[model samples]
Target: MGRRRTGEYFSLDDAIIQGQIVRVRCGACRRAANFLPEDLAAVYGGSRFALEPLFPCSKCGTTDFVRVTTYSPEIADFGRITLRRPGPKKLVQTWENETFTERSRSNYVPDGDFRF
Candidate 1:
């Protein structure tokens, strides 16, 4: 009924490398934005699965987001081919389409680049 959870698309480290941005909406105001990894790291000290323990909306001071997702359209479209998450535009307006690149976004090395 909503955007898929983080675990559905990626493991913790995979989120960091592949998540171009995180899309989240305020529970009370319905305000939403595309947050880059740097933005989330500033708030949660990490990018993966960090939206929990909800923080207040800077605009409304509400301590919750109604929905969240790793929003990358190119990946989403590609994911659908493999039955992963739906495209970002199908659910959110703030997410921009990630242009197709031949390089695999699945460069999730278990030990070299990410710890977990």
Candidate 2:
């Protein structure tokens, strides 16, 4: 059987091509923000993924109350609306060191004895 079409747009790429912008609102905290569809698609996955499941509110960190909607911006809405654009990605490198001494070795007991 052929796949059924669910909505007007199949993917984020489709939405972007149609000049749609994504808006997310958090019910609990009343926090709202707009984002570019391409920015979200880059972070979460490719354009084939749905936009709704990709956002968790940055402030509240809850997906339960998040609402995702896409709309094409009007000329009047240009300066009035602010969008959260993607920033430069930062790669942090961390190094951990482990030291072992005779005292530390004595704390290890075999046979699943966890007493220290």
Q: What is the C-alpha RMSD of each candidate to the true structure, in Å?
A: 18.7, 10.4
Report the number of the highest-lDDT candidate. Answer: 2
Best by TM-score: 2
Residue lDDT tens for model 2, 1-116: 11224464457776677777777788888988888878877877545544465757788777999876777888888889999997787665454556877677675447543332
- Quote the positional error of residue 12 for candidate 2 in Å: 0.6
Candidate 1 whole-model C-alpha lDDT, 0 to 1: 0.52
Candidate 1, 1-116: lDDT as tens digits: 23445555443244456655556677688776655555556445563463443356778776655566655557445534222233444323243456667764665346543321
How many clashing pairs does model 1 include? 0
